[model samples]
Target chain A: MTNEMMMLTNLNCPTCAAKLEKATQALPGMKSARVIFGAGSMNVEYDPNVLSQEKIRTLCKQMGIGVATVVPGPSSDI
Target chain B: MSRYNDWLIRNREKLVIATSGSLIVAAWLLRPLGNTFHFWAMTLAAIIAGYTVAKEAIGRLSTRQFSISLLVTIAAIGAIVIGEAWEAAAVTWLYIFGGFLEGLTLARTRSALRGLVDLMPRTAKIKRGEELVTVSAYEVKAGHVVVVLPGESIPVDGKVVAGRASVDTSSLTGEPLPAEVAVDDTVLSGTICQGGYLEVVAERVGTDTTFSQLVYLVAEAQEQKPKVQRTLDAFAQWYTPAVIMAAALVYLGSRNMHLALTFLVIGCPGALVVAAPVAVVAGLGNSAKHGILIKGGERLERIAKADVVAFDKTGTLTLGQPQVASVTGFELEEERVLSLAAAAELRSEHHLATAILSAAEKRQIEPAPADDWTIEAGLGVVAHGPDGEILVGNRRLLLSRGTDLTPEQAALMVEHEEAGETVAIIALNGQAIGLIGITDPIKPDAFGLVKALKRTGIKTTVMLTGDNPRAAQLVADQLGIDEVRAGLLPEQKVEVIRELQKTGHVVAMVGDGINDAPALAIADVSIAMGSSGTRVAMEASDIALIGDRIGQVPGAIGISRRILGVVRQNVVFAVATVLLLLAGVVLQVIHLGSGMAIHEASVLLVTLNGMRLMK
Candidate 1:
């Protein structure tokens, strides 16, 4: 499993953030997903063989969240 | 096509606002021509604005989630189904506009941390063989020589190997004064050099620097939810589903789907869900910018309710450095007695030895070499010198050596001890010679801090120390402390804290030593002072004051209290708005557009209230 963090540009509502986290976590081979509403970022841990970073970004975009930047590894700021 | 799709994705909100707004304007302009043109224009407005809301609602529904977007989508579709296209268009447009305003206001609250991140210099000047080269700050490796000119930010944590400068450290320590840095002095990243050029050997780069650690700690602190936030989240979990069920029952009972749809619109608890986290983020971020690091939301709550505060003495209340206060010689000059004591302590590694050596240095007395040095634990040191046998220790050491102390000398020793000075007896040739008084002076802000804590509603301020009772009492009296616990071992300090907790007092322990760790862990809130150099103390503390200023204690507590007040106010405001909107919907006084307008206004108000802590 690999952990990654991405800047979420339009994550405005807490309810939407919670849903985004749940949807990401429910993905196959995913460990956890945490969306920090205040910081406007999402952290996810998932198996690379099951789902790629591009697939994760696409999923978030389909849910109306804009992923501005994707960086390998969890956010050190957290 | 992909480029256009990307543009549409980036500007989705703005597109919704513009399309709906222009269609509504066209509907009004075409009203006089015919009802057909006006009706179709209003329908187009509703569909364009409702498209995204419906998409989000359906997406969440597929995942078995209920959200505010779901409520807004239901309301807009219901309005359109009832032939109220204008109401549907207005509701969705207003919701999107409110979200845009909220995003702007939320960004303002996060500006504190953003300012800190911006302070880091982007590029650094480093020496590469003969020529100087510029590189990204994060790319500067350890052991590289970085050059910092005046008015430029230091790019990495390093030691100065050449030149001198005074640097502004306000970003790190919250101290307004600029610190003068000479050769071999360590300089921190993110601080600006105010004068002179410096060549610093990088020791810590990237995230290892103090500035990065502070930013990381603050961000992590903001993410930790408080008990209040957790409770609210749990309440929201049931609230959303319950509201939808209630709306279904209302429609069945009253046979009025319009009122039921309005119920759903008002039921979205957007304001309540955001109240505490927004306040916690802004409060923690503002405090971190000022060099006070409250670990998390739980610690902030503890600091708010703290009634009694306990302070450790040595490095906390007083300057930890002890200095020789006075000297008295029985049958010789004061200078000779100090010289003998310094000579005997030249090879000793005791704390008192440093005091005596510093005192001798102040008097321009160079300590002579001594031989046959012997140490008696808990007593003093004895040595054979060129002049005679030198003895420097406590009264017990001198007495055990068969040295007789006159009544006058004993009285003077008692007097010095009562005045909060540690008395050390000096003897020569196995006879009582003189005595030296060493004292750790109280910090200049000690008294003021006590008064400030009292003003912040602290019921009692107690001083805890391992010093003699008389000395502890003397310092306590000067600081106006309510109680003094003296002669306590390290474990005894923890016992004191537990006793306070047993008595039902919310206690906060402030200390700056390894001995204070246990007590700090047991207290309701533990604060560590001078955390800039002490990683252990920072780890042990609930709150770490990077600066050694005693005044920040009250400042931190006061900030916590204000944050708590704001959080409570937001919760109350959000609940009241929900109740009022529910009542308005049942009475059929509020339509879809008006209900959404009020709902969005309430959320924005709560956000604005939380942002007040930024100051």
Candidate 2:
């Protein structure tokens, strides 16, 4: 199990924050999820054995959250 | 097909609002066709507009939570059930459009933070023996040698092991000038190595780097609500339930459904919910861009309200590096006195020691190495040389070492002290031999800072230093400070701050050394100036000015005051708009569509007002 914090886009309305949190929490292998709309960031804990950062990124992308932060590549953008 | 699906999902809110809006207009244009078709058209528009609202309400309701979405969804559905399709269409359309506007504003405020994140390099190139290997920046451990070529940003905080470069430190210090770095000079992460091949041994990697810490600090700072935000939050907690009850009472008293539904639309706490957070985010983001880190909104408030600004003289006001201004020899010639003091101070790392050694070097006086060298902390240094035990420090050192100065020597020391020159007494074998007078050059920015603070409504400006009273007074006079309290130890500085508070002044202490840490802790707000190089200074201060420039002091205060002002304006505007709309609805001057339009307009207006806080 590991915990990671990353910036998320489209958290414009504070009301959307709870919905995003619930959607993220319902994902497989996710232990907990919290989206801080004020900070425009999210902190999540999950079992890496059943989930990966890429899978988490995919989940956010599907949920229409903006670009995932901390992706490893030539450019800083994921 | 998948890409199209993704686009649709991303633009779902906008698309739904547009579709529902066009359908409502079409229903009006084609109303002459038939009553049944007209009714169906209006009902279709209502469903399209209410789709997202109902979805959101259900999602939140599943977790046993109630929100504005639930209230909006209930009101929209009730309007449709009561055969008022036009009211249903207007309510859901305005509500979703308002949400879209808020999301856009949030993106604008958070983009300031995004700029910092973009500056971070994801990967670092490290040297493993002879081969250069690319690795994640977080995986690069401390003590590993990281190499950077021309035009690349430094990936870690470390000392330069080899090569020379002029690195642009604008990102960290906000100083546009490129600093020259040779062997042994430390460099921070996020600074671009403009032109050089440098091999730096990493001292701080990943999250420990200054750039990373700044990103983390700023993100957290944006989340910190001001005192007014908390009070408004408490008011909002009771406000939602009160609005629900108000809506029910209005419908029961007048028996009018349209007027009651208008209350639900206007009483959503639309602008009030966004006013404080947007202002706080914009304010913190603006200051962070200028390399000023105000820890949070609470600290931002104290900094804004600080009436008195007390400065630590050495590094904060003066340039901190002193020069050998004049030398006096009592029992020996000046040359002999200089050589004795220089020998004992040659190996010491104190700023005054460098001055003594450099002065001796300029005069062609060679300084031999000394043994039994021990630093006496704040007092000075002691060592044994060819001329027996040599003591070099201030009067406190002499008094503590059981040496008393003659009246003539004491008079000479006062002469230099009165001239704003630091007197370092040199003694050999318990006999006072000479006093080497050194003067630290005051920063040019410090000259008009006092007047600038006054212009910012600072009630008092004070200079607190461990230097002698006469030296401290001379600096205070030059800076035109309101008060001078000198000859104080670290703990004594805290006493001064406490007394300032006792006299009903909210004091802000500015310093950059360990000696000032205690005082910085006790003040209403502590500002650490010139913190790009000092870890302790940043850690001790509530607000850290990354650049050494004293000019930022006023700029920091100006930004804080502007933030406080903007947040206050937002709160007043948010609250007033709500009360005005409520009155308009009671007088029946505004209907459902018009009230929703005015309500959403106020929400968007407050957000835009808050965005103006950004640079």
Candidate 3:
């Protein structure tokens, strides 16, 4: 499992962040997902074996949310 | 070609808008030919535009929520049901176009912080066993010496161990000027190195860096809504459903399908929903760009309306560290007097003791061997020596032992006291010798900041200090402060702030947030100075100025007022536009197309107004 931060785009309301958070959490192999609406970013902890970062971007795009520039987190201890 | 294909797929909504919008224009142009040609063109336009609207509406309905897109979709379909194809086409087209433009602008505002995250360096060069190796910035261990070259960002928070360089700390301080750095100086992550080489030992990496904390703080600030914004948001929640129910009522009563649909189109409250947050986002961004972080929209509101401003004198006004400025001895040398005071204060922990000890050491005065050092509460300490018993204290301490200050000595003590120095009188064997003058000079920014605060309409400026009256008065006089509260403990500062607040004044206090925690917490708006180094400073205060300059206090207040003003204007404008659009529908003067245009225009206008604060 690894955790990463991704900058989200076009989030006009805080509720959009909530909706996206719920969607990401429901995905398989995801330990947790949180979207900070004000910061336009999301933090996710997931098993890379079941779900890849590339798939997360595609899923968000389908939901009308754009995810850009995946920032690597210190995933060792996390 | 692949990028072009990606763009086309991503912007399919725009394609729908373009195709439908052109169909409407085609229908208008072909009107001269016949009603049949115009009817078909308009019908096709309605179908094309309404498809995207319906997709979005269905997507939202699956979530079991009422959204603006749902209202727009229903309105467009209702127009088509009434055989008003032109109205149906115009309604959907206007909604999509307005939404497109709104998305573009709001996206820009949201990127203000995303831009900061992008600047974080992803890689670092760490020295391995024999050679330097490139590693991910977060993977680098603490104490590893990392090399930063010209034009690259420093990847970790650490002190420079080698090399001379000019570093741009603008990312951290919002200052564009390159700060000069050499060995032993501290450098932070996310700041670019400009034409200089430096080796830094990694201390805090990744999210633990000060720059990352700033980003997180700003994000947290942006999420917190002000009191007025909370009220407006609650109103918007009810207003949208009310508009839907009102439209249902209007349709039942008048059976005017067009009028009811028009009401639905204009009643989304889109502008009002976005008004306050957009302004707040812009305001926070503007302040962040200046290295000043306001806690939240609520804090911004309080700062904007602050009436009385209070300050902590030591670290907030003067440089907190006192220094020995002058030493005067009537019958002995100046260095001898300093050595005598230093010996008496050798085991003392008073702030002024450090000044005396440093002064003696700088002059290479070997401290006279002394024993039995005892400190009196208000007076200085007494230490016994070989030749005669040495006494270093105030005139009262000397008077108690029957050694009063001579007239000339009294004049000298008064001069040093008036000059804002804490003087310690040194006496040997019950006779006065000389005094060491220790002064904590006022910061250069304090005087200018006071005048600026006055110009910004801060009616009363107060100075609260734990120092003596003479020292406190000296600062008050130099800064032209209106009120001086001297010899105040931390709790007394809180009382002073509360007293001002009782008289119906909004108070703002600026302090170091350590000893001044009580006053800072009690004040309406607490501003912490030089918060770049400590998390406690940011957490304890309502606002944090990362730089040491207190002059930004007035600037922060002024900018907050302007932001608050813009927020009010946006809110009022949003409500007025909605009300006006509804009135047009009631008077039979507005249709779905014109109503959607006006609503979108108002929303865009409000967003643009908020963006003005970004500059």
DockQ list for all candidates: 0.26, 0.33, 0.41
Write one digit per residue (lDDT tens) for candidate 1, span B1-615. 877887787677788889888999989887998877887788888888878677767776676766677777877788778777777787777777767777676666556655666676778999988789998887889999999999999988899999999999998898899999999898898899999999999998865676766655554565677888888877776787888899999899999988888888788888897788778877877887788888888777888999999999988988889999999998999999999999999999866998999999999999898977988899999899898898888989977887767899899889887777898999888888899999998888776888899888899998888988888899888988999999999899999989989999999999995778888888899898854466567756778897777779998898888888898999999999999999989988977778878888898888888888888
Residues B532-576 of candidate 2: C-alpha lDDT, one tens digit per residue:
466656755778888777878888888889888888887888889
Q: Score residue B482 of candidate 2 by CA lDDT.
A: 90
Give the local distance difference test score of model 1.
0.83
Where does candidate 1 stray beyond 4 Å?
A1-35, A41-78, B1-11, B25-38, B59-63, B120-164, B181-189, B196-206, B327-347, B359-377, B381-391, B400-405, B426-435, B536-540
DockQ, candidate 2, comes to: 0.33
Task: Give the winner by lDDT.
Answer: 1
Taking chain A of model 2 alone, its TM-score versus the true chain A equals: 0.79
In terms of DockQ, the best-performing candidate is: 3
lDDT of model 3 at residue B379? 74
Q: What tens-digit string does per-residue lDDT give for candidate 3 at B1-615? A: 856765665677678888998999989997998988887898899888878777766765676656677777787788778877888888778777766776665566567777877887889999776688999888978899999999999998998998989999888777778999999889888999998799998888877777666666665676688877887867755666788899999889889887898888888777887788778878877887788888888877789889899999998898888899899998999878888888877877755788889888899988876777777778768788765788887888898788888898999999988787778888988889998888887888777888899888899999998988878888889999999999999999999898899999999999987888889889999888854465576666788887766878998898888888998998899889988888888888987777877887888898889888888
Indicate the docking level reached by candidate 3: acceptable
What are the chain B TM-scores of all models? 0.85, 0.83, 0.82
